[model samples]
Target: MSKTVGVIGGGQLARMMIPAATNLGLTLRVLAEKEGEPAALAVTALGSHLDVEDVLRFAEGVDVVTFDHEHVPQAVLRELVARGVNVQPSPDALQFAQDKLLMRERLAELGVPVPDWARVVSSEQLARFLADHGGRAVLKTARGGYDGKGVRVVRDASDADDWFAAADGEALLVEELVEFRRELAQLVARRPSGELALWPVVESVQRDGVCAEVIAPAPHAAGKVADVAADIATTVAEALGVTGVLAVELFETTDDRLLVNELAMRPHNTGHWSIDGSTTSQFEQHLRAVLDLPLGATGCRDEWSVMVNVLGGPATGAVTDRYDLAFADQPTVKFHFYDKAPRPGRKIGHVTAGGDDLDLTVFSARAAAAFFDN
Candidate 1:
């Protein structure tokens, strides 16, 4: 029997899952906000994920419900569970991804290595934390923050006055500004029945708080770094009862210590390279994990896979307009574009190049992505 998986967002992540779902013979359905969404190819219903009626209506007849983004309201998720809908990575586990403050509190209890942080609701509290942490801190709204939004670097308490004023009486999360050598991301998938699979820890490059590039297997990360990253992800998965893909973003500090930075419960930007570089893509693995199917091997298809995102594409034409030049210049590179209108600082697509020669592979990806730059 074929199982139908319903995704709650119609973004590129959901769009990318369509081919994986087809290969696995699973039916893919999406609850999109409107027409022309990237996942419009698989959309079965058009409604707001925030609305109880819309989400409940989309849940009908699907074997399992998942998400493209974590912005879905907890009340809606719990309601789905209460009504007998199988929500993968249940609201209990999903909350850690949704609410940053709760995530910090729980990770601290679990003894997960994280940055020094505090919950502050006022400038006085923020001022004290700043004073303790060298007059500089990273302040973030506990919820609704992604891609650099709702996050601020404060040199003084007054820098966060606006966020505090708009926090809805909620304590925001503030942490010591971490000094790190580089950023790394670990991707893992766990089934409800306890089986788990992990991919190689990869290095991620962020430009203006958005992922711009990824290098698989994280150069020079064979022993302790890889082992620790995998351990951290496994511990979090088992403890939180997470099902489907979990991305743990980490900081490899200048002090040689790895610290947890952020968590995403679904397919993440860092793992996007696996779509063309691994034995099994994260999207395929996610479907398998959510359905309790046997997971696939995560071996690399190449020694080095470099993925560069196409950000802020051409100002006038669509992304496809540049394919003519890109395809000719980098034949070995794999290009993927989401059907989204170009805007400043938006991720419109990505190109991946994999080979034993890291330099050539990196160049191929960069050259291909450069074609799309405005």
Candidate 2:
């Protein structure tokens, strides 16, 4: 008998899992937010993720429940757990991914390297933090932030006046500005039985705080740095009881040390290259981990694999319309579109290419992504 996995969000992540689930002989049922969403191709049930009734009803047919995004309400998750639902990365672990403050506190308890940070509840506290941090810091909402949203770089107390006034006593986080040389991401998959698998540490390039491209086996990541990254990911997964994929975003400083930047509990954009670059993609590994199946290998298929995100530009045509031009220019490039419409700066798709030559792989991936620009 085939097992069924229910995903809580109807986004590109869920859409990408459909092919992987089919190969693993598992059925994917997505709880989509609306009709015609990206994951509509799957067995979809429409409802608000926060609605307890809807979510519980959707859970009836699936063997286990997971998430495409970590936006589910904590109360609802606890209710699911109370009712005997098989929710992978149980509410206890998922809380760290949902609330940034909780994540920071827990990582610090585990001896994980993190940037200097403090919680600011009022404008006065914000002023003190800025003064101590060279008059500038990065402020973020403790919850509901992603893709550069709900984030601010402030130099003065007034810079956060809007947040302070509208925060309604909610705490905001302020961290010392990290002057990093580059950003890196480590992706790990863990099963309930303590089995763990790790992918190559990759370099992630961001534009406007959004991931623009990723290069697997990050260039020049020799012994110590890679080991530190993998160790950090392993520590987090084991300590937090994470039962699926955990993406640990890191900051490589000028001093050559790595610091934890963020945590994502589901398939992350940084691992999208694995679809074509690795022997087993993150999507497949996530399913296996959630179902308690043996994890797959995370080896890179080539010396270099580059993934470039295709962001919506000023163009108005469908992404598929550019397939001809992109294929003609780089036939070896692998393109994955999310069935989403064009909108400035939105992630509509991505292009991946792997080969022995790093420069050629990067160029081919970028060229294919650029073809969709207009």
Candidate 3:
């Protein structure tokens, strides 16, 4: 019997991990919510992560259960562990990634630098936080939030009144609007045996709260910035007892301080460039970490690597339809497309370009991605 790895979500992360698992001779199984998800190739079960019975049935066949996303409920995860199923990045560690409020509390305990935050269940409490912090703040739901979803910026507390009403007394996490010069993400892999490795910190560019592009080893982040980013990721991985790839989204504040912005306990959008530019992609490293296997080297294959996401692919037909143009225009670029349908703001695919010249790499990556624009 082959070592089987079960993924709880059938999104693009799982889709990308399938090839890495196959290369290692492991059977990758995904419990997707429905048919036709991106990880359709490896989807062995059609089930919901929120349904305990569905997850339990899926986990019975795999050697270890991991995740493609952090949305799995704690009750379901805990049940798997109780039944003697091996779950990497156990529910205890994953809760921090699942709930922004809990994440803030735990990071605070770990002495991690983060934006000033408060848990507000009422409009009065939100207004007070607004007054204390600059009359404006970033509001977020404590759970089930990702990308640009469940997050908003508001100057008036009333702007979030509908959310408060919808919360049904559940507290929302509100943070002081950060003054960031740029966003950076540090990718780290940790195995259950306590070994850890980190990739160079990369700068992430955001458009409408969604990651648009990423530049590896963030330009000019050679000294203090890179060092600090790596240190933060290492600390969190160790303190939180996280196993598998951990992505620490950070804000390089205008004042030169690096603050934790968000956390992901799976392969993240920022680290997608590693598939083409690093000696070991995050997908491969994630599999190794969860299985407690030796980690691969994290060295860069080029001086610079730029990854640009293809958003809302071509208005008509599929992304494949425009590949002729993209491939011809940017021969040096490598493309990875999710077999997802085209929709506004949806991430259909991405292109990565690596070269000694940073400007050329960036231009090539962006050009390839633009061909898929709607």
Worst ten in a row by lDDT for model 1: 160-169
Task: Give the lowest summed-lDDT range of ten residues in model 2.
Answer: 313-322
Residue 298 lDDT, candidate 3, scale 0-100 = 96
Tens-digit per-residue lDDT, 172-286, candidate 1: 9999999999999999999999999999999999988999999998999999999999999999999989999999999999999888989999999999999999999999999
Name every residue pair that clashes in candidate 1: none
Write down the TM-score for model 2.
0.99
Q: Write the per-residue lDDT of candidate 3 for residues 48-165, one digit (tens) a residue.
A: 9999999999999688999999988999999999999999989999999999999999999989999999999998999999999989999999999888999999899999999999
lDDT of 2 by residue, 228-341 (tens): 999999999999999889999999999888999999999999999999999999999999999999999999998999999989842866677777878999988899988888
In model 2, the runs with Cα more than 4 Å from the true position are none
TM-score of each model, in listed order = 0.99, 0.99, 0.99
Model 3 segments more than 4 A misplaced: none
Report the number of clashing residue pairs per model: 0, 0, 0
